[model samples]
Target: MKIVLASASQFRKRALDMLGVPYEICPSRIDEKAIRDNDPASLTRKLAEEKARKVASEHLDAVVVSGDAVVSKAGRIYEKPRNLAEAAQFLRELSGGEFQFVTALAVMHSQTRRMLSTVEVSDISFRPLAEGEIQSYIEKYSVLNYAGAFESDAVLFFADRICGSYNFVTALPVSRLIVFLRAQGIKI
Candidate 1:
């Protein structure tokens, strides 16, 4: 089946690549706040639905995929930091703290607009980070690329350990997505 990745995230692209499935990016431009009130699972599902809908409306016979991943801590949702200062703040808040990452995946058909979803949770343990380290990491790795300003550069040292899919922490859960694609006979 033809699949469209309703996101331009490199992390998500990489995740899909791991599954050996072919997909194309088609980021959704929906107002995320419109469905923020929903719980973690529903929030992701709705976001995915909206995103996939955006692309599906313009395509035919394709299943569009959309997702939203977040770092939830102390009831606060941490998304990708916009700049170095905010990225530093995000790292500071996460320093020596343990937090959970919720990666939500959605698959919607192009013709029927039907949807299916899955939420994958991953835990990350942050190491004690110094101010200089955070600043340097931001300058070097660019947190704007990921939720919570995380990257695979030297900044990964900030994580002392991780439980669950490290890939999920980045945003997309390849393992869970594979199952969904397989169920749909996508040959993932």
Candidate 2:
């Protein structure tokens, strides 16, 4: 079966590449900001499902994979930052605190109309960050492009601890994806 990824995220693409699976990119052009839910997990899953469904409609013969992520802390769900200032704010708020980094994945087989979905939650603790460190991180990497305004790999120095699948925290949750795909008769 043909495989397609319904996202434009470089992190997700890199995760898929690590799986050694051949796939095509068909970015789902959905207005992500329009989708909202009070629960972070539910919101991420909804977004993932929507993205997969949208791409599946256009590629009826392909199995489309899509995912979404959010950082939840103190009852607030943080998605990608809008700008550098927002990124800095997010980092500052998260400094020296533990937060849940939740990610959801959806895989749809358009022909069979079968779908598999799962959510992975990871706890991440950040060391107390100074204003200068936050600013330096923002200037060094594309922090505004990532949920929570930080990337695990890029912010290793600032991350005090991470408990869960590092891959999931990074965004793709490939281990879970592999299991789900295998159950659907897809060899990766």
Best by TM-score: 2
Deviating ranges (above 4 Å) for candidate 1: 152-155
Judging by lDDT against the true structure, name the best candidate. 2
Tens digit of lDDT per residue, candidate 1, span 76-183?
788778777888898899898998777788877777667778777778888899998888888878578677778655336877877876555347666677777766
Per-residue lDDT value at 130 in model 2: 91
Clashing pairs for model 2 are none
lDDT of 2 at 143: 86
Worst window of 10 by summed lDDT in candidate 1: 37-46
TM-score of each: 0.88, 0.95
Give the number of colliding residue pairs in candidate 1: 0
Off by over 4 Å in 2: none
The number of clashing residue pairs in each candidate reads: 0, 0
Q: What does candidate 2 score in Cα RMSD to the true structure?
A: 1.2
